[model samples]
Target chain A: MRIILVGSDKLTYFLGRRFTSKGDYLTIITPEEEAAVDLSRRLKATVIAGDGSDPTVLQEAGAYQADVLLALTDRDQDNLIACQIAQDRYGVPQTVAIVNDPDNKAIFEELGVSVAFSATEIIGSMIEQQTASEEIRNLVPVAGSGVTMTEVVLGPNSPAIGRAIKDLDLQGAVVACVVRRGRVLIAKRRSYLHEADRLLVISEDDQYGQAQKVLTGEGA
Target chain B: MVSNLIGGNSSASKYIVVIGCGRLGSLLAGRLSAEGNSVVVIDQKESAFENLSSEFSGFQIVGDASEMATLKKAKLDKADCLLVVTREDNVNLMVAQIGRIFFETPVVLARVFDPAREAIYREFDIDTISPTQLSADSFMQKLNTHQVSTSAPTEGVA
Candidate 1:
């Protein structure tokens, strides 16, 4: 796929190497000439040194042929404009941007960016999951799928400790698997939950809270 | 045309928010303030405010125009008009969009350096000024007039 990346940071280099290794055509636009030269030498991709948000620069970077555009600039405004121009003018199918300010994520989405992610929000959510409780160990969101995988450890007082997987009242979630004493077991209908068993639940993103409540008898 | 868009001649105290205290922004804010209108100028750098004259009676805000926090602090909702003249075309476009779409400000004007980006601003019904295009057109007209006068004298001699 033809990919256009805006901004030249560590993330840019990582993505450039991964995509080029996969034989995908990559074009990188950055404002720093030195960084562009370094990136061109390191990665098998075209690098152009210019303002990524400028329409002329984007045109020169072959935005028209881009299957996806990723705007990872530090400035949210520049990232937003680069994505906007790539989508609106170049007819790129998908555009993603990194919002420096978490508050601007919604605004970027409202303005028609395909995906707008904030690093701070992601890190904050990870921290929240770590400090949430002993029972809930982790929450991993499946990007673009609207699904989440939550790892819940059953404690002595867990509501599902004595019940079978089929008996648990899950709204839109299912017990995908269970780990008991380091043994991975595929969850079956008659699989009985036990204390110290780690249940990996896959559920719709919005229904995770209800799923958590059903297993722990406490709201997420 | 720009002054007319802001309702130039009328003597009413209209609250205005001017983004970017650069040359154009400072000049516009000063003129509006002198005309008895309440004006507020916002810029990312405080030093940009030094361009404003002492006679300019208006509030100054040092913050990014593209951020919603800065716009809220400037009370953009209370403004009768918004003027954006930041150096970056994208910054000017973003700020003007926030003012026009989010706050639904009645009058929004932004100066876009790149003439190619003017269409997007006009699509949203925001007034945009392209200095490069404007100056180029003005220069072309002057060159044409000079040619006409010079050719007339040559024609008379012939």
Candidate 2:
């Protein structure tokens, strides 16, 4: 696949290297002439020195044939405009942008960029999730699916302890499996819950709170 | 006329928010406020606000226009119009998109230095002014008028 990566020299170099190794055509656009020369020597990809947000620069970078355009510039506005030009003008099928300001995620998505993410936002949420509750060891929300995977450890006084798997009214959540003393146990109707057993629960995003409350006996 | 385009009733003062606070932003804000319309100018650098004239009577915000918090502080959602005149074309375009798409501000105008980027702004239904293109057109018209009047190159220069 033809790919165009704009800005963030280090990220461009790494991604360019990875994609080129997979036999994908990679083009890197940067504003620094010196960096362009250096990157061209280091990577097996075309390197162009120009403003990423400029339509002429993107045209020169072969954006028309690009299957994907990744705008990883530190400046949120530059990334946004680059992605916009790539998608609207060049007709790139997929456009990904790294939003420097987490608050701009909605703005980027609303503007029609295929994927917009913020490293700070991801890290911030991960930190919050880690410290949010003691019983929930890990929680992950599947992107665009409205499904959540939660790893909850049953406590001694938990209402779910000593109850059979089928008897636990999880409010539409399903118990995928259980982990006891690091041993994976597939959740079955006859399998009984035990204190300290880690349950991997899969549920709709909105039902996770009730599911967790049922298992851990605490409001999430 | 500006008030009418922004949907403000005739004889009523319209709220205008100008981003950048550069020469154009300051001057436009000053003129709008002088016209009895409420105006607010925003700039990343506080020193940029020094460009505003004494006749200007409006709020000044020192903040980045790309951030929603800053725009919220400027009450951009409540503004009748938004003028994005930042020196950076991408910045002007980005802020204009936010105002038009998120805040739904009426009569959003942005200054894009790169003429090639005007298409993106147009596709988003945001109005844009390209100074580079405008100046080039003006220069071309002047050159064409001179050529039509005089055939001799030396005479045209003189």
Choose the strongest candidate by TM-score.
Answer: 1
Mark the 10 consecutive residues where model 1 chain A has the least summed lDDT. A129-138
lDDT of each: 0.89, 0.88
lDDT accuracy of residue A36 in candidate 2 = 92
On DockQ, the leading prediction is 2
DockQ of 1: 0.46
TM-score of chain A of each: 0.63, 0.62
lDDT, residue B140, model 2: 100
lDDT (tens digit, per residue) of candidate 1 on B29-133 = 898888888999999899999999776899999998878999999999998999999998888887887888788899998999888888755765768999998
TM-score of each: 0.76, 0.75
Q: Which residue pairs come into collision in candidate 1? A: none
CAPRI-style docking class of model 1 based on DockQ:
acceptable
Candidate 1 Cα errors over 4 Å, as ranges: A133-220, B154-158
Off by over 4 Å in 2: A127-220, B1-10, B151-158
Taking the tens digit of each residue's C-alpha lDDT, what string does model 2 give over B100-120? 978999789999888778856
Per-residue CA lDDT of candidate 1, range A3-35, in tens? 999987999999889999999999999899999
